[model samples]
Structures are given as structure tokens and as C-alpha cells.
Target: MAIEGPFWRAIAVFRVASLVYATVLMAQYRGYEQPMLGWLVIGVMALWTAGATFAYSVRALRRWPLPAIDLLTALACLLASPYVQGAGQGAAGTLPVPATWVAAPVLAWAVYGGRRAGTAAGIVVAAGDLWLRIREPDVPIMINGAVLLVMAGVVVGHVARLAKQAEARMQRAFEMEAAQRERERLARDIHDGVLQVLALVQRRGRRLGGEAAELGRLAGEQEAALRELVSGTAPQPEGATDLRTLLTRHGSPDVTISTPATPLVLPTETARSLAAAVGAALDNVRAHCGPGARAWVLAESGDGTVTVSVRDDGPGIPDGRLEEAAGDGRMGVARSIRGRVAELGGEVSIVSVHGQGTEIEITLPA
Candidate 1:
């Protein structure tokens, strides 16, 4: 939790107020049996208050020991009330030695440890005050003070916890905003510099022919990959896309794609993710199976769900092949296909039979 500076300043102010109140009560009553002892205790409290204010003001010193010591000191004063004011003196309406000074430790606990600690501190102080007034008859004042102390502890602790949470959320929002801005700037730089050069190289190399044409094809593939990368990183507008349209674009002479003629609209992000997963499956088919291998993509939408299956009529994956690939840290199936679908609240399944074919199916909620 981020402790604010103003909270410590408020604590310092409370300590000073408590000290002033204690001093005034001691002077007003003048009921201590040992006047010298009472004065000595007042002087000690004054000095301690000043030292505590300085210690808490320094951020590094504001930790467990400080608050523990503060609580102990306040409790000690409360316990010593009988000695300072004399037995039966409080019964005659005389104030305890620390009086309002007890609030300092209660507030410190609330700021440091929130509601639970605050309540504990309040109970401890109230118990000590009650012990001092145990012999006094008609001690309603002390009981009322105890109630108020507990209430203050609870309220202050709750507020402090809320403030800390609010600060954390604000910090996270600022960090995310900065990261988005940086991603946009990098996307612009790639589009203007690397992407343009790659496109020009591909165009010029294709016109040159022969080995140059093959290089041009590779360059064209790289340019397409770069475009996809930039598009994925760039911020997207809120909208929906027709899933059929997106999938239909992936069909080629070597690959067959089938989808409903009617539009299947989905959130832009969900459609993009599903399309990317299907693309990964197709890429696997092209890389592992021959480029000439025929593949079919089938899409179905019904009952608030959409299913897309990519099947290829090529030599199927041998048993344990995927596990062996995974052991070698090849995560194409794990990350590219399964990871994408899982993130979109979807699932991916693969079925393969040796010498028959392989099929990858993805199911997603609409």
C-alpha cells in the first residue's frame, strides 16, 4: 500500500494535540498526589511527542518498530495513571495522565495496518483505561471515551485502506496508457521505414525474374508477416466483423475454405483471434505436409457458438510426434493455436491418424 505524506502529517498533528490536551488537564486539575512526579511525566510526554513527530516524518523510520513503540508508550502512561493521579482520584472526576494522548497510537495503527490493527489498538487502550478506572464508581466518561476510540479506529482505517487502493489503480492506469502510446509510436516507425522498403524490394525483384523472382516471393511473404505483426500490435477500434468474410479471404487455389453465405458477425477482436488461430493451423499444414497438399476449412455457427475446422488430406501426424515436438520446445500447436483460442474463451482439439489425414478443430462462443 502506498502511504501518503499527508497521513503522517495528520498523525503528527494528532500527537501535538494530545500532548497539549494532556498538559492542560494536568494543570487544570492539579490533583496529583505527587505534583513533582506528575510534572516529570508531562515533561517526558512532551519530549517523546516531539521525537516521535520527527521520526514518523522521515519515511524510512515509519515502520513496525515505531508504531509498536508508540503503542507501548501510550499503554505505559495509561497503566501509570493510578500512580500519577493517585488511587480513587479518577473516581473524583480526575482525568488520566495521557488523556487524549491515547488517540495517537490508535491513529498510527489505523494508518499502518488498516482496520484490523486499528481495532486492536483501540481495544487495548480501552482495556487499559478501564483497568485504571475499575475501582471508580459511576465512570461513564471513561466508557464513552473507549467507545469513541474504537469508532475512530474503524473509520480511519477504512478510509486509509480505500486511499491506498485508489492510488494503486491510478498508477496502473497511467502505466497502461504509457505502454499503449509507445506501441503506437513503434508501429508507425515500422510502417514508414521497414515495411515500405520490403514492399519495394519485393516488387523490383519480381520484375527481374529467375532466382530474383523466388527472392521476391520470400520478400512478399515477409512483408505480409510484418503487416500482420504491426496490425496486431496497433490499437483497434470498437466494432464487429463478419466472420465469414474474414475466413473467406484465406481461401487460395491450393486451400479450400467453406463458410455460410449469410454473414456471421462477431466482435472484431474475437474474429481476428479466431482467424489467426486458423491461419496457424494452415501454416502447420503447409510446413509439415507438402505445399501441394489439399486442405479444407469449414465454418459453422449455431446455439451461441462458432466452430471452425481445418482438415488436410496428407500423411497424418505419427503417434507421439506432437509430444516430441513439444519436448523440443516447438510450441506452434501450444501457443499459436491453443493459446489464441483459449484467450478468446474457446477450445482447440486435434485428431490425426497415420496415413489418413490430420484435422484441427476450434470451437468458440459467439
Candidate 2:
């Protein structure tokens, strides 16, 4: 059964109201006794009972448990009330001991919630009645009440633990929702602000002359990096891609970025991811093989797939070395290239021979 917090709140309210009723009855009965003394003691007990009720109402606001106060109040009544009983049972009738009425709310606070709160209150009640134990050594009534109160406290403590666990779970749920929204927002900004600027620069580069054309070329590389990020195709950024453009400018002054001679259609998303992957692969050629490293960019389309290969005449990756490089957080080859390719239902295989060179193969479903 789903236990709504309001249900516990209603139970707390009822327990308090019952205590208030018991208080009023005790006060009315004591009005016929030594008016002043009787009224004063009743008022003190009533105040304590009211205090316990107020604690439950705002218990959640407190960082620590507060229902302990209710238990303390009960113990006070058990001890004090017995002492205030009839001084002479000879000619006069027995004076009423209103301890149980005070004890009732304390018990409820302990039991309703769980054992800890209940046991604490029960100890006070039992200890408070210790005077009776001294007077009648044969009767162990005080110890009996104490044992019962302890049992109640144990139950209340367990219940409070459950309530606290529920509160923690509720707080964590709110935090996760807030975090997910933040990730979505960051993705949008990279697409609109960074990616858009890079795209503009790439478009203007082909027409510009001299250094202006070089500036546009750098922008084109950034566009590819941003494109991968916006799509979440690559978890890592292609940082060394800037070097790829420097190599291209030096190696071939009239760099012709050729598209297929025949019209080949690809998913807009697939093309964007492929561009980012190719951009990272080119970066590896420049950084490791050096700017003088001769490289070829080839794209072939057929069989509902497209493959882009970057082959470089630089020292190739050692056998089983690509995994070691990726493990170090240099995700240029892993996150930026393989990650993007994998997202597009693609395959990547790197063939490198010592002293020969390296060839990176990437094939993606169109």
C-alpha cells in the first residue's frame, strides 16, 4: 500500500487531539481539589502535552528527531502525578493521578512512528514511577510499564527510519531531472552558436584570396568538429584538427575537396558524423607523421554505404597500440573518429605496418 505523508499527518493530529481531551478532563476533575495547586500542576502537564503535538506537526523541518520531547513529558507526569496523590486515604477519598492521560500521547508518538521515539518515552514513564517501586517493594508495576514503553520505542524508531529514507529518495529524484535539462541546453548552444559560425567560415573560404582564404579554411575544420559535438556522434572533441588544415595548405596550395563525381545521397546526420570522423583521422596524420607526411582522402559510395579512408606515409601505429593511445584520454582516434563512425552504423579498421605508414578505414551505412 502507498503510504502518503498526509496519512501520517492525519494520525499525528488525531493523537494530539486525544491528548488534549484527556488534559481537559483531568483539569475539570481537579477543579474541586485545592484549587490553586491542582490548577497549576494540571496546567504544566497540559503545556507539555501541547508541546509534543507541536513537535510532530513540524518534525520534517527539523534536521534531528524532535518527538523525544513528548516522551520526556510523559515520564515527568508518571513520576510527578504519583507524588501528588492523596496524602491521607484514611477519612478522604483517593486523589486522582492523571499520569496515564499524559502518558497516552507519548506512547502514540513512539508507536505511530516506530520504536526509538516510543522506547525513549517509555523509559521516562517507567523511571518516573520508580517511587512506587520503593514504597511497595513487592509490586513491580513501575518496571512493567517501563518494559512496555521500551518495546513501543523500538517500533517507533524503525518507522521513523523508513520515513527518513522516503524523504531522501524524493530529494534525489528532483536533482536528476535538473541535471538532464542542463545537458540538453549545452548541446543546443554548441549547435547554434559554435557550429553555425564554423559553417559560415567554411562556405566563404573557397572564394577568398591569400591569408583570407587560409582563415576560411581553419573555420571549415572547426565546423566539422562542432558538427560532431552537436550531433553527440562523438563524445570527445577533435582538438588537433587545426593542424590538419595547416598540412593541407602546405602540401597542396590548390587543395581540391572533391565530392563524388556522381551524385550520391547520404543521410544529413550520417554525412555530418562522417565529416567529424574524417577530420580527426586527418589530424593524426599531421601530428604523428609530421606536416610533410603525404596523405590521401578517398570516399567511396555503394551498397547503401559510404567509406572514407585517410592513408598517410608516416610511421604507422604499432600493433595493438591504438587501444593504448585511446586509454590515455586522447580520444582523437577513439571518441572523435571511431565513436562518430560507430554512431552512424559504421565500421572502422586501422592498418598500420612499422616503417611503412598507416591507413584508417571508416565505412558507414548511408
Candidate 3:
């Protein structure tokens, strides 16, 4: 069975205990004759006692705010029961009725609201009853009930504070687990799908004739864009891949791009991807063309198409070698750049002589 919280459990204990206390006090006094008004009052008090307990039973199943309601009910019962005892009329034999239990409301409020408010609640309740002077004119009521109520309030308030802290920690742990799952999902998508396709295009585009060239170009562009996105530094969309802009960033300080005076507006996704592809090729130049190799970026815009060429003063690739490498499933040229261009309905071609140097001439339908 699910456990009831201290608040509701405490209320149940109080209800049964208070009911016993009230019944005992009533049984001890018999001299007061039953008056019609006294019976009516007793009936009402009985209703409150039973009603408060019923409320406690439901609280374990739902948050019923039982404390606030129970406090009012208990007060009403105490108020009605004292009149039924007929002690306010100064009945001497009945040991004088004292409605001091009215202050029990402070205990109810404290456990519900917590320690920070419990002290103030106890003060207000004690003061309210003192202000009213709940004793019959000549009677001295027991102070023990008030002291017990105050203690209950303090203990329950402290317990509630600890419960609230435990709930907060549990919520934070669930959130951390959810966040880690999302990160794993992102890493998997990048590794298996996007990166693999780009690698294939970049390698194949290097050697194969015709559309194989185009496939290689598209792959290269996607790989660059993906890398940037993963790093949280994807390029801002201005237009399609700006070959000149990308080349300038990766190109040597001496390397320059020749372009139209008006900047072309390319699709930003296309532009960044393409630029990244060219940048990858430039990286190749720097790595393979020797430290002394110089490079340039050239671009042209027309007919909804764009072309970017990265040329280097470096030793050129041998003709049969690139195809041989692809046959073995090596992906450097096939997937790195050409695949992306092919996806974009364009082609990539590389021209080179073993001694004359190399040029990566890539054309994409704008």
C-alpha cells in the first residue's frame, strides 16, 4: 500500500485522539440535563468529527488540502461541544467546559505550510484564543492541549520541508537523463548517414567520368555543412555556397579569389556546404601540394547555377591511381566533395598532369 504523507497521517491520528478526548470529557459529566439546544450542538460537533476523519481517508489518494479544511472543522466541533456541556452557563459540577482546543488549528496550518510559517501560525492561534479568553468565567482550563498542538506543528513543518527537498532532487535527475539521450541521438545520425555519403562522393568524383563527378561534389558540401552544424558554428545563410568567401577563409594569405563585383545570392545551405567542400580540397592542397604550393579560388554565376574551382601549384594526381583507389573502397575524393554536387544536380571534374600541377574544377547548376 502507498504510504500517506505525514500531513494526512498526522491528521488521522489527531482526529481519533481528539474524538477520544472529547468523548471522555463528556462521559465524565452527567449532572447537566440535556437541553434541546445542547443536543443540537452535540449533533453538529459529532458531524464535524466524522467529516474531518472522512476527509483524511481521501487525502492519501489525492491532494485534498485537508489541513486547512480540518482546522476549521475541528474549531467548529470544539466551539459546539463546549456549549453542549453547558459550562458557559457556569455549570459547576461539570468541571467547567473550556474551548481551549480551538487553538489546535495552528498545528494543522504549520504542518501544511512548513516551519518558516509554523512559528507565526502558532503565535497567531495562541494569541487569538487568549484574546477570546476561552475559559468559563470561574474555570481554569488545562493548558496541556495548547502545548501539544504547538509541538505537533513544529515537528510536521520540519518534515514537510525535507519532503519538498527530496522531490526537487528527483526532478533534476530525470531531466539530466533526458538531456543525455538527445546528445547520443545527434551523434549517431551524423556518423552513419551524412558523413558516409559525403566521403563516398568526394572519393569517386575524383576519378570517374560524368555524373560520378557530380555525386562527389554534393557529398563534399554536405560534409562541411554538417561539421559546422555539429560544432554549433554553421555559416549564416546569405546565398548558395560562396566559393570565394570560403576559399578566402581557408586559402593562404597570398591566395585570392577573382569574382563578379556584385556578390551572388546563393542558398545559404548550398553555399556553406559547397564552401566547406572546397575548403576540404584546399586542406588537401596544403597537405599534399607541399608547403610552397600556392592556390586560387575562381567562381562564376549564371542560369541558377554556380561553379567553384580550387587550383593549386602542386604535383598532379596520376590518372589511373584515383580509380584504383575507389575500386578498393577508399573514400577520400569520392565522398568528400563530389557527392554533394551530384545531389545538387551538378558535376565535379579534376584535371591534372603528373608534372604540371592539379586543378579541381567543380560546376554546379545554380
TM-score, candidate 3, is: 0.43
Q: State the lDDT of candidate 2 residue by residue for 282-314, as single tens digits.
A: 777767885446677776678877676777788
Among these predictions, the greatest TM-score belongs to: 1
* TM-scores of all predicted structures: 0.67, 0.44, 0.43
Regarding lDDT, does 1 or 2 come out ahead?
A: 1
Task: Please estimate how well model 1 matches the true structure, expressed as its whole-model Cα lDDT.
Answer: 0.82
Give the clash total for candidate 3.
48
Ranking according to TM-score, highest score first: 1, 2, 3
On residues 288-329, what C-alpha lDDT tens digit does candidate 1 reach at each position? 887457789999999999999999988999999988999999
Single out the weakest 10-residue window by summed lDDT for candidate 1: 229-238
Q: For each predicted model, how many residue pairs clash, with residues at least 3 apart or on different chains?
A: 0, 13, 48
RMSD of 1: 7.8
lDDT of 2: 0.58
Q: Name the regions of candidate 1 deviating beyond 4 angstroms.
A: 1-3, 137-142, 198-283, 292-348, 351-358, 362-366
What lDDT would each prediction earn against the true structure? 0.82, 0.58, 0.61
Worst 10 residues of 3 by lDDT: 92-101
Model 3: per-residue Cα lDDT at residue 224: 58
| Residues 10-49, model 3: lDDT tens digits | 6656655655555566566665555544445445555765
